[model samples]
Target: MDCYKKSNIEDLKAKNSYKIDLLDYSLFITFFPQLIAGPIVHHKEMMPQFHSLLNKEKALINWEFMAKGLFIFSIGLFKKVFIADSFAAWANAGFTLAQNGGTLNIFEAWVTSLSYTFQLYFDFSGYCDMAIGLALFFGIVLPINFNSPYKALNIADFWRRWHITLGRFLKDYLYIPLGGNRVSKIINLRNLFIVAFLSGVWHGAGWGFVIWGSLHAIAMVSHRIYSFLAIGKSFLNSKIYKIFAWLLTFNFLNIAWVFFRSENLSGAINILKAMFGITWVELPYKFKASWLFREIGGNDKMVGFILISFIICLCFRNSIQMLDNFKPNIKNSIIIMLFLYIALIMIGVTPYTEFIYFNF
Candidate 1:
């Protein structure tokens, strides 16, 4: 509370504002739309809007903004209901198999990891979009939380794009306060480890989470070291190098996610063993005959869905980008409504599941 007050006062001072009543401050802090799992808004970004006459008028009646908000909300609903939930079953099954001391084949390992990847992305990003849309209905603009993080070329770039507000908070509060990059190389490395370790622990209380965070810290430190080397500098501008870097980063993140999703270190290791083909090359006949492998024609649908989702994630403009040129028209309205209808149907048919980050 003191920190928020201090920051708010500093922001107001910078803007040459003298007074903010308790009511306004209370409303700003307790805004329902982003109260949980925030795309953390600062006072400077929000407080002035409350004082603006235009926003005051829009709050009463704004048909265009309403339509836009509905469209965005529908998209988020579709992502959560249709996309994220679809993967949850498969993800759970695979993780369960690993937890039971069953060794997964390469195919099963990849499917499980990739399923959770897409599931987590769509689930969290979907919720963020819904929060943003709800806030927009009241003429409040929240910051964009998720970009195309899967398309990021490096770990640092990934952090910049994924859970952007959390990243910003950590950098501003934790990293900088710990003497970020202002000291010797050894000190900077220590700072990076501390931040990553805390970030891991923040997600959950488990050795798996700790290891996941440590893996990322090591990757980040290695990337930094590589950036300073002559060989890394020489390839900095190469297209092929950029492609390789992206692939490496993407795969590393996927691998690290095993730890994040697993119940323990053993489960994570089991998945990793299968992932790298250290377990077995061929599936057992009985296992192949089981419903798990035979269902849906042996994971073709899963692979196809994953491929399509990856393509869409890689090629499509993110929600924020789409909003940049947004103008609601009759055609777009119909499209959005159709999607909303389908999403509603899916929600009715599928069992209710909590958003993944709600656990965090």
Candidate 2:
């Protein structure tokens, strides 16, 4: 339920401190439901909805949308509780160990990296799902965020599918305006690099992020060349090429995750070095299974849970597509009820954080 507002600050600058109209902006930012994490809302999306709410002279009160919203919210809750947070606890421990260095094992680093990757995805995407669901509950549709990004065959495709709103903002507000692909080849490459570097900074104010962005830019450019040479002029509709593309894309993204997950360039370097058999050492402390379950509420018994949730999340093209295939009778009813029960169980647990994207 992310919402954005156009600031009136431009007009008020002359007055230095003009009285502000808090209604629309407040509604946009502090709309109780989406006040936490967001779809990274834009000014273009919020104003119209705010005006519509005001014109109708009512707050949200539609039951059908509300029910669907509740269901989606519940599903998001399960993803956060049953999946993301659980992974986060373990991943955080692994990341903490990685940060300490000198006592990190290669196996540990790999596990932690993979765990963090899962935690990052589910944590962020679960929040986005909740946001989208909440928005729809109010009869507004927020942009979709995750679309099996793990399956993407290139950085460009991954960007198109993952964190789509942020990608849109970067492209619209940053990339295109910075002479995107319209100049000489050298300038175009420079612009792409500049846009990517800025995008990394936008993700975080650190050198690690900068490197992450740079790596992505390089990967994207390489993929563009590959696409032009391989897919663009090819008459072969071969499955082998498709598989190769997917393999290349996934590996590139996985490699970049080192920088994205690292606390700093040194940490990323150490991890990369470890990947190349630099060294391995035991941690001063051992990880605990009990702590893991206790922290996330002692329900890791079912491996099927994670696999099923991921399958459901990944297999569907979009929510509309999911709903289209959904049976409205006993099957759908059962699924909805099961989701509701799981959501309630999760709610009974300890506190939870909002999606990871709020920082952006």
Candidate 3:
């Protein structure tokens, strides 16, 4: 907007730009698929599509796109209602315990942290999937937003995979404007830190969010330094080294999520304490949440779900992959129908839970 408002006619022509009518600008801003949460699309990406659609193209909806969009939307609904919300209960109970000054056993603490971790993965992945699907319904293809970020072997790679469009926006707008990697190493690192810090603030206005950003910044900067030094570059190809690297990255993200999920600093510390083997059985308000898995009568179901979900997150083909390999057969149609039917039933039967990004 500033570019259009401030640029002279010559500058506008150079970029193949012109003033946008208010109606089209509003359409761009209010595109329902990404209005709330987004893939952070650019004007160039959206405007041309809008112009084409308005010029007698809007009526020509591609049946193939509509079918694929519904399929993707159904898959996303299952991810949110069935998978993400299933974990939300455990995560919420654990955080509530800490917030109320209740303590937790080490097992409970780990459960809480890991619950939120997986919950977040599925929740956001579902939202972006739905956004992409909905856009497809209108014959518009939004960018890929999430891409198995938990499978990343390093913090930098995590950013590359997770919330991909947001990362792209930051890299192009903030990181580059702050000099990007072309600058001196120190300044480059500083730019990196600034991008991460603003990313934290973007999530919410809280100290815990700031700390979450700081933890990520530290890890990213450390990784950058490691890469700069080129330590063990040759050994990095070994299976053992790769496994060690993956473990380090995954565990770091899991721990960092405690701060992100906590209601306050003290709550985060208690969970961290228990996670690291400090049992919380002695606190004044001991964490006695028999309801933690009351419906299931134990943590067995939760544990199994976490493991299976983790494996799926790590090993299964993502939605895009499935879509690419899609074949319209009786089996595929039946699966999609089952997902939609189950999701609709859940929506009608269960209490509503907001999407995680709703807070953001």
Candidate 4:
């Protein structure tokens, strides 16, 4: 890739690209911070950093970078263990039930879907944050892979913010090669669906993934149509309309995550059946394990934590946004230490789980 990029330079004279040594290649391949899941990097992004490492090693001792990296890492750890894991407890149970053909009421189904929705949001974002913080520790700045995707008002906007590096890769390498938007609108829409299907295949070999991808393809296609249509051209001036749009997008995503997380298509549909109230079960069915707070805690604790998670996801600035304003200070150090300590204690060598993307 580096050689190709250099070869394409318009200049008549340019520095020739050298072959990377085997050891350097191996190091980059095994860069532990982002090996499993990535802000998928290219050689151009990393090689320069590696080549200049010795020159920068001395200056790397600057306190600000170290403090900032630790601060972000601490927050990521806290997010994964203290928050994502808490949500995972319910998500795992809910999915397990669905996979096993257990029936669910409206209450149970919503809980299950919403739990997995937030679980994936926090889990993947937390992993990306940890990766970024770790790379920063070594004076390597990774590409931002996640933003506050939940805050997006439309499917297109959500896609722009979610799994950003993956979207970038797909757009650059796949979509563009398929002719992108340079072609007729119909062909462009077709190209999008192709990319979406391939994106699902890239995740794993599952029909559920295919459906998940297809549903999103339909969504994006509809969004495009809406943008081009006469009715959609007219302004929706009221805040109510904006709120409605956000709600619609958010609920669509929450529902789509069912297929993304489910073990099988049938399991996903079963959950969806309950979600759509096809199986309403209005009489408040109670099992030995009620859906609301299954294995975690009391109803109040579940409600409180979930509400808090929503506030953080919907209202607070994301970690990356906060990182921009991070100034190393005694107060910041104390908070970082506290967060780190709790995460470490909670994990205690046998973590409740690993990062979900490691499977991908």
Q: Can you tell me which runs of candidate 1 are displaced by over 4 Å?
A: 1-21, 53-59, 231-234, 284-298
Task: Estimate, for each residue in 211-270, the C-alpha lDDT of model 2 and write its tens digit.
Answer: 888888887666566655644435345677778877777667766888887776777776
What C-alpha lDDT values do all the predictions have? 0.80, 0.64, 0.82, 0.79
Clashing pairs in 3: none
TM for every model, in the order presented, reads 0.88, 0.78, 0.89, 0.88
Q: What is the RMSD of candidate 4? A: 4.9
lDDT (tens digit, per residue) of candidate 3 on 1-360: 111122332332354365688987888899999889887887766776666666765556977777778888889999999888888888998888887777776777888889999999888889888997898889777777787888899999999999988999999999999999899999988998899888888899999999999999888888899888756766888888989999999999999999999989999998898878775353325334344433222366787888998898899988776776666677878988999999888888767889999898
- Top candidate on lDDT is 3
**Candidate 2 runs further than 4 Å off:** 1-22, 57-60, 102-104, 230-236, 280-320, 323-330, 347-354, 358-360
**lDDT of candidate 1 over 1-360, digit per residue (tens):** 121234654654476364777987898889887887888777776777566533463355556667777877888888999889888877888888887787777777888899899999999998988988897787666777888999999998998899988887888899999999998888888888788778898888889889988998998788777766677566777999888988999999999999999997788889899889999756656644243454213455666779889987999988767666567898888878887998999999998989998888
- Please give the RMSD of candidate 2 to the true structure: 6.9
Error of 3 at 352 (Å): 1.0
For model 1, name the residue pairs that clash.
none
Evaluated against the true structure, the overall lDDT of model 1 is 0.80
Q: Lowest summed lDDT over 10 consecutive residues: which window, candidate 3? A: 1-10
- Give the root-mean-square deviation of each candidate in angstroms: 4.7, 6.9, 5.9, 4.9
